[model samples]
Target chain A: MGVLKAAWWIARKDLAVEIRSRELIYTAMFFAVACLLIFAFAFVEGRTTIRNAPAGILWITIVFSGTLALGRTFERERQAETLRALLMTPVERPAIYLGKLLSLLILLGSIQVVVVPLVGLLFGAPILRAPFMLMGLLALGTTGFATVGTLFAAMLTRTSSRDVLLPVVLYPMSLPALVGGMQGTLWIFAAEPNYELVQTWLAMLVFFDAVFLTLALWTFAPVMGE
Target chain B: MKLGDRLIVVLLAVSGLMLTASPYVIDTAPYEATMGLVQRIFYYHFPMAMTMMLSAIVCGAASAWFLFRRSERADHIAVAAAEMAVVFGVLTLITGPLWARKSWGVWWVWDARITSTFIMWLVFGSYLLLRRFGGAGSEVLAAAVGFFGMVLVPFIYYSVNLWKTLHPSNSVVPSLPTSMGIPLYYCWAAFTLLFVALMSVRIRLERSRGWLERAYRAVED
Candidate 1:
């Protein structure tokens, strides 16, 4: 089968399983919203503080919630005999990767859509103007997160302690995407875009995607097989 | 000693001498004392940072090689690279704190550079931690660690930038004034050689250990 077809199969398989049991996304959404509420009250906040703050809030929420979903993504596969069957197929490995990452993209992207606006609404920091830029930043940021997250999700699949291990390993690693997205998101909110910071962050985000994607491709077969 | 061994020894000795000499020339004047006598530590600190960074990269590379090739040599090289990384990583942790105490008043700040390096220590340490977790095959663990290893660099880097942190981004390797920059570069060169010397020795020791383990297993079987 073609790589795209394989990816589509994996993606569809994951989606079908999730739709049958809305267990994963529900938990992720609950955790994300709850965490945002906590961050709102738990931290010091002035109107001015909230003004430059929505970017961080969104990325932080997405990461935490995305990880919650990602940690569970492959665990169930291991628990059952499903993954071994998938591996027995003749499809290339990167297709398998793209498939797994695509699943995370859907879950996290959905949660992000919900949480970002909620952050704006409750915090009274509405996203004005630049909706396109904001959405693009989210796409870039989420892609970087999923790219790294998919790799870690595979790693955590076999380990006894995948839940906490996922965040511990993933959070510190995906800082660039978070930073890049945060900055781009930050610019989206401002009256004037900080052109230099925006460009630098965008470049870093893209560079991160290229390098880690290659590294992941090179490393995934063994990590997952073993 | 063999020629290769002697050259390494001589190079290490020369580097040490240069590290010692830097303070006298640059920080000699009574006024130039911020990173002064203590700043002389820059000579070693930069090299240690370079080695740590290099070690992390090599760990990632070796992780990939070991996974794809499934060779014992790749695994050993990776473990060796990680051991070397830990040594330099420790130096980074220690010297940065010392420099911070002297430079920033507070020894540790949740700054960009500081926090990122700390996270790297955790990540690298956890790489070693993987060897202990006997859940599955060695190949899997190596692949997992390799896959995730280098991902830490960006997060550690941009963490501070994302949230406001106290660590300044001296970026470990921006251009420097010739007076101080040139000596620092020598120190870097020296440390690079020193690290390779250490890696060679460690790789040899590791190979011996691997042979011994196999021999023991063979006899038992």
Candidate 2:
């Protein structure tokens, strides 16, 4: 199969499984809600929410639940010994990596669909301000995060202590993306939104996603042991 | 003695001599008008920072070599360089706060260089942790980690720099007076020599451990 076609099929396979079970989607969304509630308690004072808290809370909730999802997604592959078989296929390894990244982006995207509005509703963040810019930041930021996360989580699949190692490895490597996301969202949530600064941050996010995705693709083959 | 051992011995001796005389050398340099004696720590602090940066580069390059070429020697070098990064990173982190305490009246600042350096330190430290607990076939995994960390260096630097900058800029060395510059260069050489010597020892130790493991397997057969 062609690389893009194979990637689509792999992504479809994962989505089909997820659609049938709804386990990861349900759990990860609940975990994100729990994180939002916990942070609301800490940041919401009397009637007013802490200034700039929503930006940090939104990005952090994504990161935490994203890590959980990355771990379980790979854990499932490892459990059935399907990853080895997947690797044995004649399809290119980059295709496998792309497929995994796509699925993760979708999974995280769905969770955000709910979490973003909740943040705006509960904390009065101006989520509707510059909707396109917000979506661009979210999409690119999630891509950057999931690109690195997928590579590391896939590599960590065979390790004995994966659950702990995934976050330890993923967080530092993906911090630039997280910072860009938070800062962009912060600008959006500001009383007077700075579109110029938001543009700058969005540009940085694009750079990060491009560089990280390229590296992840280039290294996936060797790291997975061809 | 083996060539590696002799090299290590010579490097250690020379660097030791340089380090021993560094205090006097730094003392001879003129003090600053604003910061006075606290600026002296810059000699050590700056060199440690350079050495740590060098170590990170070396680790990343070595990791790339190991991942693509599967060179065992490269793997050994990567491990040694990572350890050096962590050791020197800790030194830089500690001395930074001390200097900042005197210079900026604060322990830590989210300055571009400081934040990126801290993140790099965490990544390298994570590299070590992954190797320790990752079990079998972790060398390749750690190599991937190192390579990714290396590529992220410039991105992180640029992003953080654009965000905030409270620390002194990077042009201090070029603008330094000759008297101060001489001592600063001297300390840099000493720290670099020491870094090379320590890396040699660590690489040798790692190779020996590999040999011992292979020999044990031979006996089992």
Highest DockQ among the candidates is held by which one? 2
The best candidate by lDDT is: 2
Q: Candidate 2's residue-wise lDDT over B22-92, tens digit each?
A: 99999888778887888888899889999999999999999999999999999999999999999999999
Task: Find the 10 residues in a row with the least total lDDT in model 1 chain B.
Answer: B166-175
Candidate 1: misplaced stretches above 4 Å? Answer: A44-51, A191-207, B1-34, B104-123, B138-140, B147-201
lDDT agreement of model 1 with the native: 0.72
Query: After TM-score superposition, what is the CA distance of residue A112 in candidate 2 from its true location, in Å?
Result: 0.5
- Badly placed stretches (over 4 Å) of model 2 are B165-180
Per-prediction tally of clashes: 3, 0
Model 1 chain A scores worst on lDDT over the 10 consecutive residues at A42-51
